[model samples]
Target: MEQRLASPLLQISGLTRHFGGLPALDQVSFQVAEGRVTALIGPNGAGKTTLINCLSGVLEPDSGTIIFQDRDITGLSPHQVARLGIARTFQNLRIFPRMSVLDNVLCGLTVQAGGSLLEALLRTPGLRHRERRLKLTALEALDSFGLGDKAGWPAGALSYGDKKRVEMARAFVSQPVLILLDEPVAGLNPEETAQIAALIRQMRVYGKTMLLVEHDMDLVMGVSDHVVVLDGGCRIAQGPPDEIQVNPLVLEAYLGRMSATA
Candidate 1:
């Protein structure tokens, strides 16, 4: 379990988003503690993806404030959010199929890249130095994810689990303060899921905060310090993993029936 900090690293307040007449996120509020792993688990159509999109600036909330490190970042573009030390992986693999594995991870460092476009075009010494440094860093990240041997291969040629690892390595390559993982283990087999789970814990050890959106209950409960449950675009229950497991509302949301004792 992660130790909670005095102040939250990210705060969402009164966040709401609507699609035409339907609400995707309804007055959602949550606090993500620094250096902790928080799991957002909910049934289908629960607005989890919508929330991620809004936070990452893929979509703007109709009304709300997103405070990161005490700065209001609501509606900032995706690159803007990433520059503020936030990185994320998609529910759908966003890997560049035609690119070499190393190049795919290199894309994540664009936010950190320095030197003017003219310098890059001229292949200045500074630009070349930065490029070499980035490649080494990307290779290290791939090694950490057990993909070093495959770094030269096309990302599309890898197995499904390997592709997921590549995406994750890309997200971590920049060492963001927070990572949002959407359905990280969705299509993995047991061994692959276990590997991802271990990697998640390893990231925590490296002092990374993670907000995970996943349907895998075992993985969620196993690695999360806190869990938030949403249903039909509304937050129903939130607490520590153990408490969330026994939460009546959570059970009802997932099972579509109330507990016998409830």
Candidate 2:
């Protein structure tokens, strides 16, 4: 189990999104505790992806208040949210095909760079020093995921699993306060899933807050400190894995049939 903090790191109240007059997320509310893994799981068309998009600033919620670390961050731009110590990986891998593995990770660290415009323009000693330091840091991040040897290769040249690891390295390099992982194990084999699971545990060990949207129930049950379920864009159930597993509403959401006890 994750060692969650005393107070919520994120508080979302009355979060709603719609398209063409159809609701995608309807009055969703939840609190993600700091230093814990919160799994967001639901059936198909449950708006899990949409919620992640809204949180990461990819899609604005029609109405809601998103409070992160005690500040209202609703409607912030993507870069603005990122600079505030929020980072994410997509359900689909987003990478520059031609960029080297190292470069892909390097791009994420740009937000943490410390060279003033004048120093950069002058190519001062300080600017060069920072660049060298960034390279070393990037290399160290890659090495942690066993990708150091492949850092010179084009990102597109790696297998899908390796590419995901690179994306994870990119997310972790900056040491963000929170990471939103969308379907992190969506298309991997058992071996690859195990690899990612191990890495997720490593992130927890380092005290990272994670909001996960994934379909792998076993993975969610094994790794999540808390699980929140959604159905037709509304939050239906939330608790530890065992409680969620037995919740009649959850079973009905996925099976489309309510139990006699429900």
Give lDDT per model, in order.
0.88, 0.85
lDDT of 1 by residue, 99-176 (tens): 899988887765546333344345667666678888899999999999999999999999999999998998999899
Clashes of each: 0, 0
Which residue pairs in candidate 1 have backbone atoms (N, alpha carbon, C) closer than 3 angstroms, thus clashing? none
Query: On a 0 to 1 TM-score scale, where does candidate 2 land against the true structure?
Result: 0.89
lDDT of 1 at 123: 60
Tell me the TM-score of each prediction against the true structure.
0.91, 0.89
After superposing candidate 2, which stretches have Cα over 4 Å from the reference? 1-5, 112-129, 255-262
- Please give the lDDT score for candidate 1: 0.88
lDDT measured at residue 58 in model 2 versus the true structure, 0 to 100? 86
Pairs with backbone N, CA or C atoms under 3 Å apart (clashes), candidate 2 = none
**Top of the candidates by lDDT:** 1
Q: Measured by C-alpha RMSD in angstroms, how accurate is candidate 2?
A: 4.7
What stretches of model 1 exceed 4 Å from their correct place?
1-5, 114-129, 257-262
Give the Cα error of residue 242 in candidate 1, in Å: 0.3
